[model samples]
Structure formats: C-alpha cells, structure tokens
Target chain A: MKVTVKLFASLRKDRFAVDDFDYQEGATVGHILASLHISEEEAAIIFINGRHGGPDSPLKDGDLLAIFPPVGGG
Target chain B: MESLKEYLLARAENGLIRLSIQAWAVQNFGLTFPAAEETILGLNLLPARYQRNQRSLSCGQQLSLFRSKVAVIGCGGLGGHIVEELARLGVGNITIVDPDTFEEHNLNRQLFSKLDNLGQPKVAVAASRIKEINPAVTIVSVYDAFTSRNGSVLIEKVDVVADALDSIPRRLELAEVCEKSNIPLVHGSVGGWYGQVTTQFPGDYTLQKIYSRYIGERGIEKDLGNLSFVVAMIASIEVSEIVKILLGEGSTLKGKILSLNLLDMEFSEITF
Candidate 1:
C-alpha cells in the first residue's frame, strides 16, 4: 500500500515536505515515522486525512498523513 | 461638560482628528483617551493615527475595538509584538503578564527588549511601549507568571486572550482557564522558521487536542531558537485573530490551525 506523507515545521528540516512511500498492508503511523527516521518523540501532532491520529492508528492506501513538531515558543 | 462632538468637529482637519487634539480633549475634559477617541469615532471622524485602518475598519468597528479588552499571556517574543499590535490597533484595555526580565539573548526577537533594560521586567517594558504607542489603550502589567491559581483573576472580564506562552504545560493550563471563563483564546507559537496559530473558543479543546500527547516543557523552539521575523509574523496573525473575535469581522482561525513554514513560505490550514 502507498500513503501520501506530509511533514511540517522542523520535522521537515532534512525531510521532504510531502511525498509518498510504500508500506506494508495495515501499516500504522508509527511504522511510517520509523521509515522516515522521524522519532515518535519529535512528532507532536499527527493527522490522517485532516483529523487527529496517533502512532498506533492504522493507515491505508491513498491516505494523507500529516505530522507536525511541537512549536511552544512565545 | 462640553459637547465633545462639537469640539472634535471644530478641530477636525478634513474630517480627521489629530492625536494632539485628542490628547488635549483627554486633558481638558479629564476624559480617558479611549473616551475621547470613541467620541471622535462616534462623529464619523477619524483619529489621524488610525487613518490607515479606514475602509478595512469602519468608524463603528474602530469604536468597537476601543471598547474591547484583551489579555496576553507571556511577554517575550510573541507577547511583545502582540501587545504592540493590539495597542496600535486601538484595543482599549490590555492586560500583560510575564515573570521574566529581559536578558542579553532576548535581543534577537523580543520586541520590547533593549540593551539598556536587560533587567527590566518584560511586562513593564510592554506597558511603557503600549503607552508610548497609543495612550488611548490602558495597560495593566502583572510581573508574575500565569498559572491556574491566578489565571482567573488575571483574565477576569477580558473578552479575548492570546497565548504567547513558551511552555506546553502552561499552554494546556491556559486553555483550561479560558475554557472555564468562556473566553476565546488566540494561540500562536513560533520556532525558527515555522509558526502555528489557532483559536480555541470555550470547549473547542483545540489546544488540549493539539498537545494531548506532547510530554515536554518546551518544543522544537529550544533546539532551533526563535527568529525575529517568524515571531512577528505569528504575533500579527494572533492579533488578527483577536481583532476578528472582538469586532465579529473577518474569518478567524477558529477550529482550524494555520501551520506556517516561513522557510518554504507555505501556509497550510488543517481543520480539526
């Protein structure tokens, strides 16, 4: 299965902003993060198709996965 | 008491009142600048300082802004710019809260920080700057950190609140307090070339939902540090959100988060 992945903020420092990658069937968000070398700790907010998602949440083909880093600064 | 409308009409230059005249009216009639400005706005006369805001903001809307109150939590990078914009936009009452003082490192992005006032409190500097920018805006500076214990008192009667805090835990706490008070919170945060803004009305749980799994005092900002441009941009967006909430004009970021990547200049809105 393939999923479109989007990264935001510092999460895109060395990574692509939006791209697609192949993952095994029934792959979870955690699997996608691991594949991108993005640690779960650095991924503050994750959304699947614009709604909140978690690491344990499963993804499907053609799904849009977005990840954002924490930006707690004044 | 004299009729301020007649007095303002007499001094009007092309139907626009100057700041000097407004100041004179405030002094002579013992009226607050906001009161005098409101009178000027009531007569369809513009305050020269606010001329740039015309068309975008009508006289009625400007008068409405002069009657609103806002509370800005944290007086650092985002807070300083927020306070400055609110005062210049003629927000009538502003309450600023921060416990930290200026330091040498804060010169990069903190708006109110100056080399000579390194030890001065951030809120104190903000109060002084607000008065200098727009005397019609009243400022209440609190030289203390915002916590759940004192949050209610700090934000009492405020129509809107802006979250410029640096701590994730504190942001969550602030959301809780605003929720209880039934106030709208315009939240903004910046780290390096990235920033995000969202509005959380009562029970929106936008902040709570955003930071649900985050388990840290700070975020990527600790590693990337903040830049001047990103801080100012986010602060301006937050101010716009506050203005919309006050005047009921324009679309706001409520129920959606505007994620800004300044490096790539990409702005994406993610709806929750």
Candidate 2:
C-alpha cells in the first residue's frame, strides 16, 4: 500500500525543500512522519488526499498526502 | 476559463446556504429562478421562520461543508472585513476572537468600528453587526485573546481557519492550532501599502518560507492609514481563498504567496 506524503512550513525543513513523500504499505501517518524525520508536534495537519484524516488514519494506495506546519504572518 | 465568481455561483441558489459552501453565492450569484420580490425581500427566499427577521441568510442547494466553521483569530482592520464577508455569505458559523476593543484610532479602516462603538469590544461589536446583516449566521465571540491554551477552544469544531492577526506571535500560535487540528489555514498579513495572502492545508509550503523570503520581520506600523487599503484588499483575497477551499472550485494559493502593493496597485503570485 503505497501512499504519497506532503510537508509544509517548519515541517518542510526536515525533508526535501519541496513537499513530497512516499511510504510503504500498512504505514500509519505517524510512520510516514517518522520516515521523514518529523516529530509528531512538528508535522501538523495531516490530510489523506485532501480529507481531514490524522496520523492514525490508514493510508490507501495512490493517496496523495499533505502535511503543513504552523505559520504566523499578518 | 470560468472566473472565480462564476465558478462558485454554479452550485449556489436563492435560499439559505446551510453548509459546504464557497464564496458568497447568495449575495453574489445571478438568479436563475425568480422568487417573490417586495421592499425588503431580495430575489432569494429565507425560510419562513427566519423571514420575519428580514436579516436572514440566503439558501442554496448544497452547504459547502468545508466552510462550516470559520475562526478568524483577530477582529481588527482586516479581520473586520473578513468577518463581514464570511457572515454575509452564510458561512453557517463564524467565530471571531479578539482581545482588543474599538478605540478612537480604529475608525479609519475598521468596518464594524463606528463612533458609537468606540469603547465596545471588537468581537462583540463585529458579531452584532454580522447578526444584523444576516441573523441566520451563528456568531461565536471569543472576547479573550488568542493564545496557546485557548487555541483549541477557537480552532476546534471548525473546518477551516483564517489568519488576519496583527502580530507575528499570534499568527504563529494560531497556525499551530490549524496544523495540529489538521485544518487548512489561510494566512494573510499586511504592511504599509502592501499585503499578502496564502493557504497552508497541512501539505503545502511552510509559513517560515513565506515569512522569511517575502514579509521579513517588519512589525505592523501606522503610516498614513495605509492599513485600511491594504487590509481591505488582502481581506478580500482571504475570503476568496476561503471560498475556493470550501467549494473545491479551483486552484488555491496552497504553496504560493499573493502579493499586493497599493503604492503601484500591482498584484503577483510567487511559488516558494
């Protein structure tokens, strides 16, 4: 079960500058966070392909994930 | 290509917008089917119960669910306008949390700030105005200031959050809430003669990049009332971002920062 992952804001620093991630089957959102080396606190807003699913949510095949960190401006 | 407005109006109708909506379709969309028209009644019809109030919200076929709860972290210059747009659009529920109250100095750009409201709480004043404009909306007032402890109180139970704050610390704090809650945060900021808006839905560009590369650390300062012009402009864009996100209509500033400078009236987008 391959799933896509995305990283944003402060969490972006832990991985590639771009927002991209891929993980193996039966991996929890938390597992992907660990693979990307992002702490639970750092990796905020986990979207399983645009839905509001969290680390505990199971990832399906071809799932384009997104993760954004906290930001303050304006 | 359909312009942003046209795109949203496609699913809208002339009634009370319940949930899952983007943009202000009732106030904005053209009437396809005609309804009754009187002195106060517009093209749309409010539910009979609310029709008596006259300030009821317009309805639509679907309630663009993503907009169910909109928490505006501030209620100042820009936050005022953002609240107005959200409420008038029948956003279902609007929660405005602001620690400050109206002052004589806030008269210039504050939409809900009037001479009589000079000493009133911003959240209270703004919510009252929203109620009068559209009683169908549920206004949540957080008279207390936004902080790490109270972040969940305001951020939770909402589908999306908008950042129209004044300082770096507050914006960052709210951002943390949206991040942890797995909610998309549409962030905006303005300086003298300039402002910017962006959307961070957990999997997009980080706030640090936008702040460091573009905004720098310039604090909000008063400069010839540039706050109103820039705030109003940015707030409109913030509403636009909110609408698009709610309706799943089109693209968003997900990984981009939109910059607008009144000095030259130039607007552009940058990907970082």
Candidate 3:
C-alpha cells in the first residue's frame, strides 16, 4: 500500500516535509510513526485524510497522513 | 444638553461627522469621547475616525465593534499583540488578565515589554500601552491568573475571550470556563516558527481534541523557544478571528485548527 506522509512544524525539522512510502497491508498510523522514528508523544495530532485519527487507526492505500507537534506557547 | 444633538446634527455633513464635532459634544455635554461617538453613531452618523473602515465594515458593523467587549488572557507574547490590535480596531471594552511581570527574557516577543518595564506587571503595561493606542478604549486589567474561581467573573462582562495562555492545562481550564459561560474563545499558540490557531465555541472540543494527550506538559516551546515573528503572526490571526466573530463576518475556525509553519511556509487546516 502506498501512503503519503506529511509532517508539520518542528516535526519537519529532522523529518521529511512530505514523502511517500510503501507499507504492508493494514498498516496502523502507529506503525508509520514508529517507522519514521517518531514516537507517539512527539506527534500531537494525527490527521488521516483531513480528519482526526489515533495511533491505532488503520490506514489504507492512497491515504494521506499528516502529523503535527504541539506548538503550545503563547 | 438637548441642543447637543442638534449641534452634532448641524456639524454632520452628508451623514458623516468629524472628530471635532465629537470633541465639541464631549466638552459641551460632559460626555466621554466614546459616549459622544456612540451617541452620534446611534443617530445614524459615521464618525470620521472610522472613515477608513467604511467600506470594509458597514456603519452597523463598525458600531458592533465599538460595542463588543473582549477578554485577553495572558499578557505576554500572544496577549500583548492581541491587546494592541484589539484596541486599534476600536473594541470598546477590553479585559486584560495576566499575573506575571516582565522579565528581561520577555523583551524578544512580548510587545508591551520594554527595558524600562522589566519588572512591571504585564497587565499594567498592556493597559497603559492600550491607552496610548486608543484612548476611547476601556481597559480592565486583572493582575492575577485566570483560575476556576475568578474565571467566570473575570469574563462575565466580556462577549468573547482570546486564549493566549502558555500552558496546556490552563488552556483546557479556560475552555471549560468559556463553555460554561457560553462565550467563544479564539485560541492561539506558537513555538519557534510554528503556530496554531482555532476558535472554540460553546460545546466545541477543539482545545481538548488538540491538547488532550499533552495535559500537564509544557509545550515544545520551552526547548524551541518562541520567535518574535511567530508570535506577531499568530496574534494577528487571533485578532482577525475575534473581529470576524464580533461583526458576524467571514468564516471562523470553529471545529477546525489552522496549523502554520513559517519555516516551510505551509498552512494546513484540519477538521476533527
């Protein structure tokens, strides 16, 4: 399965801004984060196809996943 | 002061009244500038001070702005800039809440912080700065934190609240207060070159959705540090949302979060 991954804010500093990867069938959102060396704590919000998704949420082929860090400063 | 109305009417030409007329009315009728201006506006006359806002905002919209009250929590980084813009936009009454005082480290991004005000209360500095920007604006500065006990009364008089707080837990606490009070919150946060903004209306779980996992944890900003540009940009966006809410113009970020990364210049909106 081919999936597009988008990392925002500080998450992009050490990671690719956007990239495509081929994952095995039934890859969970957590699996992709772990593969990218991004811990669950590092990614504050996960969006699958523009909607909120959790780590355990399963991803399918052609799904766009966006990850954001918590930019919680005044 | 019955003749005051006729005097103002005489000075008004083509439905537009000059600030000088307001000055005259203020002096003659012992009314404040805002009072005189509001009276003339109520009579269907436009004040020349707001002439620039004519087309962008109808007379009615301008009046709505003048009648709106907004509370800005946190007088640092985000709060400072938000207060400055709100005053310039002619928001009639503004309540500024913040307990911390300025330290030397805050000069980089806090708009009201200055070398001379290194130890002054943030709210006091914000109040004085706002007076300089717009004298007609009424400022109620609370030199305390917005806790559960005081949150309700502090925001009781405000029509809307701006969440410029720094902590995740405090933001959640503020959300609870806003929800209970039935007031909308325009939320903004920044860390380094990244920032996020969203509008949380009554019953909206926008904040909870974004910071639920990060409760009691300081944001990455502590390590990345906040930048001046990021704070200013996010603050401007927050103020724009407040203006939109007050005038009932444009679409707000309700149920959505607008995440921004100045480093990559990418802005993405995510809906829950």
Which candidate number would show the highest TM-score if scored against the true structure?
Answer: 1
Ranking by lDDT: 1, 3, 2
- Candidate DockQ values, in order, are 0.81, 0.07, 0.78
| Whole-model lDDT per candidate | 0.91, 0.65, 0.89
List all candidate RMSDs to the true structure: 1.6, 14.2, 1.8
Better of 1 and 2 by lDDT: 1
The digit string of per-residue lDDT tens for model 1 on B1-272 reads 55777789998998789988999999888898878887898898889998899869988898888889999999999999999999988888999999999999999999899999999999988888887789889899999999999999999999999999999999999999999999999999988899999999998899987888788899899999999999999999999999999999889988999999989999999998
Fnat scores for every prediction: 0.82, 0.14, 0.81
List model 3 lDDT by residue over B138-165, tens digit each.
Answer: 8999999998889999999688999999
What is candidate 2's lDDT per residue for B51-116, written digit by digit as tens?
333442233312442137788988988889999988766566788999898998788788998988
lDDT of 1: 0.91
Q: Give the candidate number with the greatest DockQ.
A: 1
What TM-score, over all chains together, does every model reach? 0.96, 0.61, 0.94
- The residue pairs that clash in candidate 1, if any, are A74-B78
Q: For candidate 1, what is the DockQ-based docking class?
A: high
Chain A TM-scores for all candidates read 0.95, 0.76, 0.95
Worst 10 residues of 2 chain B by lDDT: B32-41
